[model samples]
Target: MTSASRTFIDHAVSKVPAVTLGFWIIKVACTTLGETGGDWVTMSLNLGYLVGSLIFLAGFVVLVSAQIRARNFYPWLYWATIVATTTLGTTLADFFDRSLGVGYPGGVSIILLLLITSLGVWYRAEGTVSIESVASARVEWFYWTTILFSQTLGTALGDWVAGEDRGGLGLGYEMGAVIFGAALVVVGLLWLWPRVSRTALFWFAFVLTRPLGATLGDLLDKPVAQGGLEFSRLYASVLLLIFIVGCIAVLPQRAARRASAA
Candidate 1:
C-alpha cells in the first residue's frame, strides 16, 4: 500500500479500544475525575466560576486542537481531550445552573437540546455518526461537539438527580451513580442484542457516560452529610490523572485509523 493510503487508514478509526467495557470503565473514571477536579479548580481554589470556566474552556480548546492535529491516535492525547471535555462540562454546567439560575432541570433541558441538535447536524452533514468513521476534520468536529454536549448534559442530570429541592429526585450521589451505571449495563445488553441500530446504541452509551461521571464524582467528593467521602477534589483529580496516564502508557492504545481517502 502507498504511504499516503496507509496514513489515511491510520487517521480514520481509532486503533485503541472501541468503546468496549474497558473503554467505558475508563470513561466513567475520567468523568468522575472531571467533576471533582473541575470543582477543585473552580470552587475549592477560589478561582471563581467564571474564571474556572474560562480556564477549562481554554484547556479544552488547546487539548482538542492538539488531538486533532495528531498524526494518528495517541491514547494519551485522545483521553486527555476527553478529560478536558468532562472537566469543562462540569464547570460549564455549574455556571449555567447556579450562576444563570436556570436550575438543574432547565440547564439539562437546554444542553440536551443542544446535544440533539449537534448530533442531528453531524449526521446530516456526514451521512454517518459512527465512531469508526471519524476520518476527517468535519466528522471530528461533530464528534467533539457531541461529546462536549454529552459531558455537560451529564453534569446537569447529575445535579438534577442529587441536588436538594427544586424538583430534585434527591437520590444522593452514590445512588445516582448506581442508577446510571445500571442503566448503562442494560443499554449494553440491548446493544449486544441483534436488531438494535448500532448507531442508536452508540449514542445511548455516549450520553449515559456523562451522568455516570457526574454522579460518581459527587459520590467521591461530597461531604458525608451529603453522602460523599469529603475527599479533596484536587487530590481526586490528580490521582485520576495519574491512573489515566499510567494506563495509557501500559495499555495497548493505538493512534486513530488513517482515512481511506488519505
Candidate 2:
C-alpha cells in the first residue's frame, strides 16, 4: 500500500459517538439517571453529598481510565463513563453548593470557571475543542474533564432555577425543564445556520441538556408539594437506566470521524 494511504487508514478514530438525535436522547436520559441515582445514594441512603461524591468520583476515575486505554470506541463503555461524570457531578455540586454554603450562584460561578479553564487549556494544547478531535488519550482526558465541569455546573444551575431560596429564580422543576429545553431547541436551530460554529453549539447544547435532565429528574422525584411527582428516586433511576440501556442497544452509534485538514 502507498505510504499516504497507510497513514490515512491508520488515523485514530474518535472515541466518542457521532452527534445525532439518538445521541441527545441518550444523553438526556443519562443525565436524568445521574440525578436520580445520585439522590438515591446520597439522600435516600443517607450517605450525604461528600460520601456520595467520593463514591462516584472513584467510579469516574475507573471508567475514564478504561475509556482512555481502549483503542476504539465502545458505546457501552463510553456511555458508562458519561453516567459516571453526571453522577459524580451531582454529588460534588451538592457538596459545594450546600455543604460548603457556597450557594447555587457561587457553585455555578466556580464550576463555570473550571469548565472554561479546561476548554482554554484544551484549545491551547490541541488547537480545537471539537469532539471530533478526541482521537487520543490526552484529548479524551480534556474531553472528560470539560464534561465533568459542565455537568456540575448544570446541576447547580438547575437547582438555582428551581429553588425558591438563595436568590433562586423560583421557576420550579417543571418550568426550569421547559426553559432549558427551549434553549436547546434554539441551539439546535442555530446548528442549521451555515455561519454558526458547530463546536460552540455542540457544547452549548451539551451543557443545556444536563440541566434539562436535572429538572426533569427533580420533577419526577421531588414531593408533589414541591411541584414534583414524588416518585421514589430508586424507581425513577431504574426506569431511566432501562431506557438508556435500551437506546444504546438499539441505536445506530458510530465513532465520530476525524476532521479533514483545512
Candidate 3:
C-alpha cells in the first residue's frame, strides 16, 4: 500500500463500543432516561418543549463535538452523546408533533424521512452505514445526525402508539412496550440468520429501542388514569441515570481493533 493509504488506515479506530448484551442494556436505559429527562425539563419544570429542545440541543452539539474530537472510544462520552440525542429527540419531536400542530403521525413521517435521508447520504458518501465503519470525524457526524433523527422518530412513534383518541392504536404505554420489545426479539433472531446484513439489523434494533424506551418512560410517568404508574419524571430520570452509570462501570466496552495490513 502507498504511504497515504497507510496513514488513512493507521488513523482508523472504532469510536464505538462493541455490540454486546451490556451495550443494549445501557442503550435502553439511556433512551428511557431521554424520555423522563426530557419530560422533567419540559413538563415537570414547566420549560415547555421549545425551551427543552433548545437546552438539550445545546448539550447535543457540545457532546457530539467532544465525541468526534476524542482519540478513541470512551464509554462515558459515547453514552453521554447518546443521552443528549435522546433527550433532544424527545423535546424536538414534541415540538413538531404538538407545538407545530403536525400531530404524532406527521411528526413520525417527517422525522423518518430525515433519518432515511441522513442514512442515504451517509451511505452514498461512505459506502456503509455500519457503526463499525465509524472511524473518522466525517463518518461520526453522519452517524450522530442519523441518530438524532431516529431518536425523534422513536418518540413520535411511542406517543402515537400510546394515544387513546388521536388516530393512534390506543395500545397504552405497557402494550406499546410489549410490541417494541417483541419486535426487538425478532430483530435479534434475524441477526442469527445468514445473509442478513448486520448493519441493517443493528440500525433496526437501534430504532426500535428508542420507542421501547419512550413507551416505558411514559408508563412510568403518565397518570394512573392514563394507564401509567404516575411516577415523578425527575425521580424516574435519576433512577435510570443511576442504572446507566452502573452498567458503564461494570460492562466491558472497547473500541474495535484496526484491521491488519495485507
Candidate 4:
C-alpha cells in the first residue's frame, strides 16, 4: 500500500484502547493487582524475585506476541498484556533493587535511563511517541517496551516511598499514596491548562498511576503495624482482578484514533 493508504488503514484500526476515565480506572486496578499478585508469587509462594520475574517475563512475551498477531483491538487481550508488564515490573524491580543490592535510587536511576532510552529510540524510529501513533506491530513493540520500563520505574518509586522497611525511605504507604495521587491531580490540572502537551501529560498520568497503585497495593497487603491493613496478597489480587474484569465488561472499549505516519 502507498504511504497515504497505509496511514489511512492505520487510522481506522488502532489496536489499543482509547484513553478515557475508564481506562485510568482499569489501569490502576491492573497495577495494584500486579503488585499484590507479584508479591504473592514471590513471597507467599517462596519463589525468588528472579524466578517470579522470569515467569512473568515469559507470560508477557506470549501475551505481546498474541496481541501483535491479532488483527484488531481486543479489550481483554490488550489489558492482559498490560498486566503482564506490571507484574513483570514488580518482580523485576525487586530483583534489581534487592537481589542486586541496588537501592531505590539505583533502581530508579537504571529504570529511568532505560525508559528514556526506549522513548528516544522509539521517537527517532517512529517520529512520534504518542499513543495516537501506535497503529502497527512495530510501534506496538516500542509501546510495550516503554511501558515495561515505566512500570518498573513506578514499582521502584512506590516501594522506595512506602516500603521503608524494604530499604525505602519509610514514609508509610498512606503518605506514598497521597504523594502520587497529588501528583496525578497536578497532571490533571496541567491537562486543563490548554498549553500543556497532551502526549506528555498522558505519559505523566500513565507512569504516575503505576506508583499510586503500588502504594495502594502495599497498603492493602502489609501488616497493620507496618501501616497496612494486613490483608492477604492473593485475596487482594483476586479482588482487584475481579474489579478490572467487571470494569472492562461494563465500560466502552474503543480503539484509539490514529495519527499520520511520519
lDDT, candidate 1, equals 0.81
Candidate 1, 144-207: lDDT as tens digits: 8889998999899988998896557898887888888898899889977899987788788877
Clash count (model 1, backbone only): 15
Q: For model 3, which pairs clash?
A: none
Show model 2 residue runs off by greater than 4 Å.
1-11, 260-262
After superposition on all CA atoms, what RMSD does each candidate show versus the true structure? Answer: 2.7, 2.2, 1.8, 1.9
Task: Report the error of model 2 at residue 86, Å.
Answer: 0.7
TM-scores for candidates 1 onward, in order: 0.91, 0.95, 0.95, 0.95
Of candidates 2 and 1, the better by TM-score: 2
Please give the CA lDDT of all the candidate structures.
Answer: 0.81, 0.89, 0.89, 0.90
Q: How many clashes does each candidate structure show, in the order listed?
A: 15, 0, 0, 0
| Model 1 worst lDDT run, 10 consecutive residues | 253-262
Which order, best to worst by lDDT? 4, 2, 3, 1
Encode model 2's per-residue lDDT on 1-262: one tens digit a residue. 5766544433545567788999999999999999999999999999999999999999999999999888777999999999999999899888888898988888888889999999999999999998877756788799999999999889889999998876678889988998999999899889889899989999999899999999999999999999999999999999999999999999999877654432
Residue 262 in model 3: lDDT: 20
> For model 3, what is the C-alpha lDDT against the true structure?
0.89
In model 2, the worst 10-residue window by lDDT is: 5-14
Best by lDDT: 4
Model 4 Cα lDDT, one tens digit per residue, 149-178: 999999999998886655688899999999
The runs of at least 3 residues in candidate 3 whose Cα sits more than 4 Å from the true structure, single-residue gaps closed, are 1-12, 257-262
